[model samples]
Target: MSLSSFKREFARHYNDTPANYIKTKRLEKAAELLLISDERIKDIAFNCGYNDLANFTKSFRERYSCTPSDFRER
Candidate 1:
């Protein structure tokens, strides 16, 4: 099947929007990277498809209520 069909099927199965599905996956991966790697914040942002560090920081803070560094520290 096509990507769109697969996304639709997955969303139906999970009862979530495709965008939300992708965001959840990205956040999970970001948490893993933060806990397991010493990589730079900017590198993690870019690797997670965020081109702007500020935007990435905003999103990260919104989700975790803290900056990436602070999250890592805890």
Candidate 2:
């Protein structure tokens, strides 16, 4: 399926907008990087399409309720 059609179908089934779906994927990738890589926070932020560490941190905290450092510690 085309990306637009897939997005529509996904939203119809899961009630998630394309932006949210993309964000969810990015967050999942971020979690993997946190667990598996020794990359810096700035590198992770840029890789995940976040230009600013503060913005990344804010979104990460909002979704997970913990700082990235804290999340990594656990």
Candidate 3:
């Protein structure tokens, strides 16, 4: 299938775009790690498939309405 066609079908079936689904899953894992592990935020971000710490922080904040550190504290 064409790229656009595949994207549309994937979204229809999953209720989210492919990229967004992956991103949300990554952030969810990061949140779980933050609460359960003693790892640094950077390490958690990396383990969750984010190579850039700032980008990870921004995405996490957007999803949880708080930074990773703040999320851990609360």
- lDDT by candidate, in order shown: 0.86, 0.87, 0.96
Candidate maximizing TM-score:
3
TM-score of each: 0.78, 0.82, 0.93
Residues 1-74 of candidate 2: C-alpha lDDT, one tens digit per residue? 89999889989988998899888888778878988888887799799999889988998998889988888888
Whichever of 1 and 3 has more lDDT, that candidate is 3
lDDT of 1 by residue, 2-74 (tens): 9999888988899987887777788768877998999998899889988898988888888889999898899
Q: Which is the better candidate, 1 or 3, if ranked by TM-score?
A: 3
Q: What is the lDDT of residue 44 in candidate 2?
A: 91
Model 2 misplaced regions, further than 4 Å = 1-10
Worst 10 contiguous positions by lDDT, candidate 2: 23-32
Please give, for residues 1-74, the per-residue lDDT of candidate 3 as tens digits.
99999999999999999999999999999999999999999999999999999999999999999999999999
TM-score, cand. 1 vs. native: 0.78
* 19 Cα displacement, candidate 1 (Å): 0.7
For model 2, what is the error of residue 52's alpha carbon versus the real structure, in angstroms, after optimal superposition? 1.3
Clashing pairs in 3: none
Of 1 and 2, the candidate ranking higher by lDDT: 2
